[model samples]
Target chain A: MNAPQRIVVDPVTRIEGHLRIEAETDASGKITRASSAGTMVRGIEIILRGRDPRDAWAFAQRICGVCTLVHGMASIRSVEDALHRAIPSYSIPRNAEIIRNLMIGAQYVHDHVMHFYHLHALDWVDVVSALKADPKATSSLAQSISNYSKSSPGYFADVQKKVKTFVEQGQLGIFANAYWGHPAYKLPPEANLMAVAHYLEALAWQRDVVKLHAIFGGKNPHPNFVVGGTPSAISVHSSSGAAKARGGQDGTAVNMVGLQTVQTVIKQMKDFVDQVYIPDLLAIASFYKDWGAIGSSGGNYLSFGDMPEKDIWTPDSFLIPRGVILDGDISKVHPINMDDDNEIQEFVSHAWYKYKDGDDKGLHPWKGETEFNYTGPKPPYEQLDVDQKYSWLKSPRWKGKPMEVGPLARALIMYATGNKQMKELVDYTLKTLDVPVAALFSTLGRTAARGLESKVIADAMQGMFDSLIANIKAGDVKTFNEQYWDPASWPKSMKGVGLMEAPRGGLSHWMVIEDGRIDNYQAIVPSTWNAGPRDTAGNSGPYEASLQHNHVLHDPKQPLEILRTIHSYDPCLACAVHVTDPEGEELIQVKVK
Target chain B: MSLEDIRVVVDAGESSPYQADALSGNAPVLLRELAEHVRQLMAAGEPTAIDLNALPLTPADLDWLKATLGEGEISVTLHSDGESTLAETACPGVWWVTHHNESGHVVSRFIEVAFVPELVKAHPEDVKTGLEYLESLIFDLS
Candidate 1:
């Protein structure tokens, strides 16, 4: 019997923030155990304390640059929810809801596309092999997959030349420090070349589509978020000749030109997702069929449904349904009782946080503490003490179960709970790949689910836009409900949970507003659920379980397989930490007696 | 009603403490990279360019960098996508190039360590096309 070799990947690149993964592989190179550690900490919740509840979104929005708009949306939704619960008339306009949908839906499509092409695609596609590809064959291969119009032989040749020039330059830039020639990369030269071209195209595509956010929210990457409704105002002058005099309506307001731009961007987004993204996803996924059976998270899934038609209070109107699926049972979907303390709780037994009562006790977000207790080995160390506090992320469990969140969870809930469009899309993916329904539980399935949902959300964005237009046409241009704007109409103390299906996964911001100020604010992000360490019950997180399931590192030195499974979750570790900087003084100085 | 009138600023004392200076402690690191790039160009005679847009350089850092490198004799403007300026730094073989989109937004910026920046030079295919055009003009004259 041979001893299991431990492989550690500290500071995983191409992710939003710092994440370290340590896996132990057996004699046959199959991973037996894995630990995920979120290395950075930011005291966002503590900073939000004593701040105006309405202004908390601006601060919370800085959680992650990649997940830019989600935290802002959630924070505003928390405020809105708290105020609405207090006052019956605290509701946003229909146009506001539609606009919010459009914004978040765009986020889903944009984030998923960027994640696929820029982040996860490199795990499967070999760039160095792409240099040897025949441009003509690559064009044919691309044309056969999708009519993206950029599939001309000359176009591929030019791209190939550009890449050749870049490689010749000797500075690979972001493409450096990657496991380029690793055996885990399975795509052929032509496929790799096609994918490489789309990678660059997606970068440009994302830059243009994110302008939709800027149009509505006033900027991309931490877009402006208002409490009751969208921040942008609708221009009445657009219908009359006054708009032209005002330079085609105010740039700050949503006018005909801005709407036209939104429509064009949506069309471009839908076309690219339909033509390039999905087709490329299918083409590349067909080659890596074995990943269909690998990286399963014990078949537990959760999705706090998003893209609401009305508001967060009503779950029935959500495009992505909220439910919990335990032990791979698609037939039985359990409703999420968010208010119940035991239903959704965070434990820090194996994490770097301390609960006043005990580390093993799970506390609801309403009573969640942000106390930091570093009990593991210091930084610049070789390994983590997996048995002790090894991570900054507190393990968030739904009903005492380690449930996987994000695209795969949402996809499964949608399929199980019967979302027509999502069902057809998931079925189509399975049928095209010739894999079974169980394949939807693996790393490849997780990646495919992201593309499928992106298409659904992109298509849904058109409906949201049309609804907004119709509302505006019907002489309702009210973008904000200022009835709740005055904090004087607020209750003395109130708490609310803002749940949304962030592009990454189920994200919820729990806020306790006391006397018009934020008493406590805690955001339980998707990555915390996916990348958290072992809980008190000793249940490994989604990342750890997936790595231990069927992951076998061909070369432990080049752990490309580990990256594929982890990147599948689109891990944003910066969103997970709720503590202050370890080196700096405590942001709030919570006394631990 | 004007954009300039809407002012909202949060003063965090002399320094924000949260926002790190782009080149404060890392000027030497970037200078070291530039030096290595320059060294490679000198020893191997291989040209290289650093994408300034890719780096986290603040506006002040950019000004400081420009001041450190200073200006050279050559400065060329090319109207392609929109407008591009390729200027040589005081240090020979170091060029500062900035490219803008059609809307005049700075799309890409780079620091090129080359005798002539790549964007300023005509491609071999374009040169061939230029010769063909010249031949056509001669034929018309004849």
Candidate 2:
């Protein structure tokens, strides 16, 4: 039957970095299960094992060019927690927290805006449809939206011209490989025109917001963070050495004038997150009414809450307390237990690690064993099917369960907690978009909720920033604590897991120090949780479970719909591997070992 | 006065015979010499702080530098009219000096460095890289 129709989509278009999807269907094309395979596995874990604990944070951040700071925060905080280290006081002022929140808010805006317009837009907006849209109507409509105009005359006209140029030149950004003009690629021509125009605008603005990271953490993608404390140098001296860790004060904050300019920039960027970003999300959600029924995955959710106390940077007193929701039930919040944090274990069985049957199952660092000898990659699943068992990724189970991550998990946790602002914004959004009250539980809800959270986070950040400025003006700004304790001075054994709610979801580092070196240093990153393969019992990873039963239309060649559903999860498969044939060809296969 | 320091302990398993070859790549000779110096210093209290301002860093130090500092710049080059206007290197304020055998070795033990919190605050990004570099250097290469 035409060689069992195989579709291999390598270098998945319109996402940061690279990924490939290979799926196969049976004869008469009814369809069997599919294997989501990953082509790249550049040994980030093994490389991290022997490095300095602090350096691990920076290196880990590089694992994904997109989720950089999240990794950095997770890694650093993990080490600090393991060592029972704490930063100084006078660093956790409202301004300090606000500044941190602002940076994070900026990143969220940049990532979400980029995700909506650049990556996923093509799935719904046919680029070719822009030519048919009345430019005059587009401009008038754009003008009507107070947030969408350019002061420059004929500027809207120029943006439209650029969209036309992009379409004509076929420069689809990294979206070069995405399905731009395929059927099932829904959305009206006008919608496509509007989205395409915004895609171009967001690209430029995303850069401006990214600079926010540079101002604070010191770079985009991976920024320098303050763990166990705030970042910035001495607010007291505002000079050499004193103002080292602090981003402001010292020469770091020397620009009183620049602060005003920076604030203006942040406000402008904030306008997009509040006005354009959220509205765009709500607008898009309106058309995909059925997403609620299709996109939900797993019953277990986790959050190692972030944002510390108003005047404290102690790991003990984190902002978002670590808690897990079992079976969609948010009845009571339990503290994150590293020992009891079962349900999550990586089965190197299908991955490139030598372990007992490839299920490299272990609790975490403190309680974990130090047997890191390597053999080769093994098929984690017990049942063997050579055709699909050669990938380097392991199937990790959370509480022996498949847990979903990303903004959805964060949104759910926030939603369950009665976050008044989040609830208000989401509730209003649902009404404005004409979605069912319950649609807040679906995929589109996740997409919109993440954008809405950006606003809440931005507003919160402004508070943190101002407080920090006041602290600086009050003559206090030391965020670094350089205390080194002797390994022999105390505990020979301490097993602790450092937790944080990374932008992607839960991020943790399990560390064990014996005789002073990292006797066992293992990290369960967000990507690892999101993109794992099947466990021995054969439960799918979070994204895999979400993709189950997505009705594949007539031709499998046009998969932009399924891709949009999955990309919404923002799979950082770089850290997690998937099943693939040794031939390195396609993604369609049920033959998993 | 509170003592300000950040300890970076590296794994020095390369001395294990099974991994002699891989451990001593372009580094063995230099590390051996540094190890000898560390072995001598072990009897004294281990000084984990290394002032970069006072460094003519040896090969072992270089390895430690790359590991700990990562791929970020140590200095910002402010330019005027497209020309280098100011080039001030970060002091990296504080440092760590790792003595081998947990400060027990007398001859074969070696030492590497990382950033102390003070220096880390100065070049915050490098603090992490430096710590990582120490982790890599002090690891049991075997």
Candidate 3:
């Protein structure tokens, strides 16, 4: 038997942001204890302490670079929800809702595809082994899987030449420092080659799909957003028509050409998801089927559903249903109340934060404080004192229980809600993979759920586009609502929570507005729910729990199994660590000689 | 949501509406990186490349970089898998490379600190394949 060993993978590669994972293994090489730490601290909430609620979206959207528009959307919804509290009839135009839906749906398709290929695929596919594969055999394998036309022998040969050139050059730019040829990588050489080809294809595929956001919001990353509705308005006349004389309203406004571009992007998104993304996902997943029994996080899920078709506040018209499933029971789903402080609360016992009164008690987001108290080791040191303060993320729980939130949670919630489309897609995937229902609770299940929901969202984009077109033809060109737009509409004090299903998971922004200015703002993002540390009751987060359950590291030095589970959540730490005490002094000072 | 209430914070000589502070650009960090890579290449005979597309550079930062690192003598363009351009910066051993897809959209951009950009070089296997093709052509002639 081996002695107990400890391993740390600091600054996990191929992730959206900075993270550090420390795990201890027993004599059998099975993980015994684990701790997830978000090393960076971002205090965007503190920045919005006194700004106008209407302008919060601009500053809030900078929280993340990958999930660019989600924070902005949530901020806008927060302001609108605050105003709607004073005036009941306040809502954005129906076309605005549809346009937002189209943008969010495009985000899901684009972000998920990029995650699968660029971020998570290296965990399973061995790039060095791909060099040993024959191009013709790789082509045959790709053709057998899906009818993607780019899978020709000549095309694969060209890709192979480029990869060979890159490898020979001895500078593997992005592919450097990876655990290549690790024993845990299970895919065959041909599958690796085919996946490598699609990896490059997805890089190009993402470039065009984001044009949908540019068309609607006027940019891609951190696109222009507004409080009342979407940024752009509809122009009934075509860009080349008489409207051209009034100031060249081509891409600036939603005209015929813009609508046509949107439709084309929709087609491109759906086609790629159907032909390329899903096939590659299923193919790669089939090779690692044993992962079905690994990395389950206690089977507790939560989702604040998004994509409203009619009213912004109503959940009946939402495409994704919201609910909670506990203890792996699909029969009973507990409803969530955002206003109920007792339901959803965050604890900082195992975190580096302290409440004004007590660090042990859980506070809801509306009352959540951001006071940092670092008691761990100083910089350039080994091993955090895990029993004391460890991570920068607060432990968020529902009714004193840590819950998993992300694609897997959303899928389970939708399936438990008896959603017809989701049910059909889930059933088809289960049958195709020959995995039991319990498989949906594991690491591979989380990855497959992302692809499965990407398909659903990509297909749903067409319906959203059709609805937008029909509404335009019906002479409804309104995109904003001005009923409560004026700050003088007089609500001395108001509080609101903007909830949405971001690409990663359930994201909610809580705001307390006073005199048209933001008093307090707190965002409990998806990664905070998924990658948070232990709570006062000694409960582990999804990231820690998943790593501790049935996880065996073949080589402790190269923790590829840890990367597989962590990357499966698509952890974004820049959006997770928002605690800052602000001591009214500079934390660092530089001196010049 | 109203356009009138949205104030333009920085009004300058820029044509586009989006304005950013020139002082807060990525040019300085990138310059330091280029200097480090050049030093490494000289001392250890090691080559390094930085993917510019991966960096968060505003247009102002790019313009500043282009003006600072002027062009050198040699410029080459390869027309394979779309059009790619590799041009040497005024600081020798530093090259600017850009890869465009078939639609002419820039897929990737990089700065390579090396003697010659690797993409411009012909791999040995490709040269061997070329030799085989030329031999087959001679056989056809016979």
For this target, which candidate reaches the highest TM-score against the unseen true structure?
Answer: 1
**DockQ for each numbered candidate:** 0.02, 0.01, 0.02
Tens digits of per-residue lDDT for model 2, A244-265:
2222222353233235434655
Who is ahead in TM-score, 2 or 3? 3
Q: Considering only N, C-alpha and C atoms within 3 Å, which residue pairs clash in candidate 3? A: none
Cα deviation of B41, candidate 3, in Å: 49
User: Which residue ranges in model 2 land beyond 4 Å of their true spot?
Assistant: A1-6, A24-32, A85-102, A143-146, A151-153, A169-177, A226-231, A234-250, A253-258, A310-321, A330-335, A341-343, A357-390, A485-495, A577-593, B1-142
Report the lDDT tens digits of candidate 1 across residue range A2-116: 4579999987877899999999999988999999999888778878888898898899899988989999989998998887777756787788888888888888889999999
The lDDT of model 1 is 0.85
Q: For residues B28-140, what per-residue lDDT tens digits would candidate 2 score against the true structure?
A: 34445444544544555343433333444333333443344333234333232332211111223112232223212211211232222222234667788999988888895
Model 3, C-alpha of A219: deviation from truth (Å): 1.3
How many angstroms is residue A293 displaced in model 1 relative to the true structure, after the best TM-score fit? 0.8
Q: Interface RMSD of the predictions, in order shown?
A: 15.8, 17.1, 13.8
- Tell me which residue pairs clash in candidate 1: none
